[model samples]
Target: RTVYVNGAYLPETEATISIFDRGFLMADAVYEVTSVLDGKLIDFEGHAVRLQRSLDELEMAAPCTQEELLEIHRKLVELNDIDEGLVYLQVTRGSDGDRDFVFPSADTKPSLVLFTQNKPGLADNPAAKKGAKIISIEDIRWGRRDIKTVQLLYPSMGKMMAKKAGCDDAWMVEDGYVTEGTSNNAYFVKDGVIVTRPLSNDILHGITRKAVLRMAAEAQLKIEERLFTIEEAQAADEAFTTSASAFVMPVVEIDGVALGDGTPGPIASRLREIYLDESR
Candidate 1:
């Protein structure tokens, strides 16, 4: 497989970054994942804009321009023969030959890397049909959830916790409210209305969430943006999640409680269909 590191494209095994890089040492980096369908990037512009926003919020320098980033994404997708899959991009403050708690000098350049995953049946993932079962976990990570940083240890652990509980994923709760899934934005449907937590530092502003909500509004589906507890979601008629990789995934059960006959709800199914149809 081909991967991009710094300015060079090379085999994945050949790609390298300094061990002292801040992204590795301090988790000081921003990243984005853009899905690919039919060899075309899905919402590339949206991901690029969000990437820039994350960099700006963290006061990190962009490794390259948006146009350059797009080119690299396309190039890697092409090189990797990605049809339906994902492109992962990361930019980090480069190593300054020494590790320190203080920020590196302004003259230090940033490192850029990108790669693609080939998922032939990404849009038709069978899990979407069966719907996902999720367990709830506490949100104990740092407060800057808004920034798309690589500090994902807690989320990784949360996913593991869910797996150990025989669940597909985990929803993070903070102060009795659902912030989001371990890696996606969370939502539920009640009496035909879609309820998802509003955008704030409490949750990562999902690119797919914005698109799904817009399409939902356009389709005249009832919508509401507010905090909903796990109990509320479990009581909901149906529930789902949105992310660049997963798109829209239905949630059938929460913490051992089934929602609506333990089946994927019609609204969630329809939204997933709409999302796939429109996105493709």
Candidate 2:
């Protein structure tokens, strides 16, 4: 596959980062992933705005203007003909001589990387049809998850633990409150009411999560953006996750406990339809 590094596009094997780059050395970077459907970018403007916010929060300059970035992303998508996949982009402080806490010189340019890849069709996966299981792990991420930074070791480990436990994903709990999934947003439905955590620095404020909320409102379903605990989730009538790839998927069980009837529920299916319709 072709990858865009800095201002150039080349084979993925040829794309490289400097050893001294802070992104490589200290995971000092931010990223955004947008799904491409039939060559059309989904929620492109929103993603771009969030990217800018992340960069600004980290005190890093955007490598290019929003229009330029969108053009580049479109070009890369066309160049690769990635019709049904995701576009991943990242920006990081540039390489510098070995240093621990000091910032790189102002003259240093930020490193930018872009790539696109096909995502497995979750709808076609039987696991999704049956609704996957999830495990609740303690939220061990840094306080700034709102920045969308690439430092993901804690979640990575959490996901691994989830996998080992025969679950499809990990839901992170903190101070007895459920935050979100490792790479997605968590939501549950109770008596036709959709409940998800409110946007905060502790969560990523997912694009799909926002879309789901909007869809629920249009569908006349009650929406609640507040903290919900694992115990509450386990008792929910329906549970699901949202992400760029997995638009909306039901969670039949959590932490070895079955939710409702232990199958995809009506509310999750309805919301999934709304999500796809609105997102497209």
Which is the leading candidate under lDDT?
Answer: 1
Q: Report lDDT (CA) for all predictions.
A: 0.93, 0.88
| Cα TM-score per model | 0.99, 0.96
Model 2: per-residue lDDT, tens digit, 114-202? Answer: 99987556335466678979999999888988889999888899989988998889999999999999999999989888999999999
For candidate 2, what is the lDDT?
Answer: 0.88
RMSD of each: 0.6, 1.3
What are the clash counts of all predictions, listed in order? 0, 0
lDDT (tens digit, per residue) of candidate 1 on 4-104: 99889999999999999999999989999999999999999999998999989988888889899999999999999999999999999877978998889
Tell me how far the alpha carbon of residue 53 in candidate 1 is from the true structure, in angstroms, after superposition: 0.8
Q: Would you list the clashing residue pairs of candidate 1? A: none
Relative to the unseen true structure, what is the C-alpha lDDT of residue 109 in candidate 2, on a scale of 0 to 100?
91
Please give the RMSD of candidate 1 to the true structure: 0.6
